[model samples]
Target: MKKKSTNNKKTAICGVLIALAMILSYLESLIPISFAVPGIKLGLANLVTIVALKKLGVKAATIISTGRIVLSGILFSNISVIIYSLAGAAFSIIVMVVVDRMRVFSVTGVSICGAIAHNAGQLLVAAFMLENVNVLYYMSVLGIAGAISGAFIGILASIIIKNITFSI
Candidate 1:
């Protein structure tokens, strides 16, 4: 009974976090970052993924991450956005899970890996859609952006989960 309740509580928490991520994604779309960089955000939604990974585990984090991206795509963006987000979220979450199991790095490191994976995933999708190999050129910038943002968000998630005491 206790285990069941704990799982239920975790599920609820993940759900709420995913919803918040969706809202953040939409809001992010509304206010384009002033950065000269074409496509980047603070990656605020990434916070939820990081938290979910620590609190819920890899599988739960994957589910929530994918769901949030897909729902956000459907609600806020187009099929292109869907393709990009799905690819990135899927690849990044998988890398995160693998890194997490290796235990070679701290949670922050794992999160950064996820962020880098996200860019690779998105680049792959962009290349597929554009039908051009030149897409790789853009990756260097995205990777750098991902690394910085991912590390920041990952650390933030680690801190929040560590301090919350939410049984998550």
Candidate 2:
């Protein structure tokens, strides 16, 4: 039936998006740039997540984000990394979904909030692990980094969403 075919197509697209997110995560790891502060990176994989959220919906985006975290964690990182990634991705995706539904801000604004939530989630985990509330101090720096990286990823996602057409 057409419904089954559509489901199949959506599954295929989700798989491809997951692979792309993993690739982007890998590429981001390869980059030598470090901001001296911990948990600061380009968040390149977020581009796929944002696009998936807009094109497919929150459910697809959730699957893509969670899949990327688990697979990438197993391949390129450790258990701790997985924990942090899960927390960040969960928080980020939740914020993105809420902001997206509100429709007040542009995609870029939603992305920026998602990025900040991601950082905050990670920081919460880190603080708990370290048993030091001082870890919260890092937010000032991470916030700026998140805004910048999120803006870049958001712009990229917007462009892709505008240009590409998918049957699913």
Candidate 3:
């Protein structure tokens, strides 16, 4: 009974987190950044994922991250975008987890790494699926953009980590 209840609580929390991610993704999409690249944004949703990783561990974060990208893709983007989001989320989470294990960086730093990894992941997918290195032609610019976004999300994650006193 206790176990079941705990799981139910976790599911509820996860649902909220997923919703938060979707909202961020949607809002970010609505804003316009310079259109030098076809797809680029702040990755605000990643803030939640980073928090989840710290609070609930990698598995929960991964699940939430994957679900958010897939569902958001279904609602707002086409199949190609979905593929890119999935690829990016997968790669980003992997980097975030590895960095977490390293214990070398603060949450802010971790977020920065996560953002870069997200871009790298998506670019790799583009390279693999589309067979075009042109995807990377913009990576340097994207990296600079990613650093800014990552820092913003990371700061948010750090607050969530610092202020909220709870467990997964």
Candidate 4:
């Protein structure tokens, strides 16, 4: 049936996006760029996430993000990394979905908000794990980094979304 075929196509697309996310994550880890603050990176994998969201909807985006986190964690990092990644991705996606529904901002703005939320989520996890309020001090730095990285990813996603002709 057409419905089953559509589901199969979606599953395939989600798998590809998840693989792309993992590759980006791996490549990003290979680079030594540091912001002198913890938990600051390019967030390159977010491009795939945002693209998946725009193209495939929230369910697909959730699966891709979750798959990326778990696979990358198991392959390249540890349990702690998985926890932080999950928290950050969950917060980022939630904010993005809400902001996206409002239709008040461009993709770039939505991405900026998502990036900030991601940082906040990670900070929350860090604070909880470390049992100290000191982690909150990193917010300002992380916010700036998030804005920059988010804009970069957003621009990339926008371009990719425009050029790609696939539907899910």
Question: Each prediction's TM-score against the native?
Answer: 0.88, 0.96, 0.91, 0.96
Q: Which pairs clash in the backbone of model 2?
A: none
> Which residue window of length 10 is worst by lDDT in model 4?
31-40
Per the 3 Å backbone cut-off, how many clashing residue pairs does candidate 4 have?
0
Task: Give me the overall lDDT of model 1.
Answer: 0.83
| lDDT (10s digit) by residue, model 2, range 1-168 | 999999999999999999999999889889976777754799999999998898899999999999999998898789999999999999999999999899998889999999999999999999999999997998999988899888988888888999988887
* Whole-model Cα lDDT of every candidate shown, in order: 0.83, 0.91, 0.85, 0.91
Once fitted onto the true fold, the runs of candidate 1 whose alpha carbons sit more than 4 angstroms away are 1-4
Residue 28 lDDT (model 1): 72
Query: What TM-score does candidate 4 reach?
Result: 0.96
Where's the lowest-lDDT run of ten residues in candidate 2?
Answer: 32-41
Clashing pairs in 3: none
Q: Which stretches of candidate 2 lie over 4 Å from their true place?
A: 36-38
lDDT of 1 by residue, 20-61 (tens): 888877777788674658777777888888877777777777
RMSD of each: 1.9, 1.1, 1.7, 1.1
List model 3 lDDT by residue over 12-31, tens digit each: 88888999999987888788
Q: For model 3, state the Cα shift of residue 23 in Å.
A: 1.0
Predict model 2's lDDT versus the native.
0.91
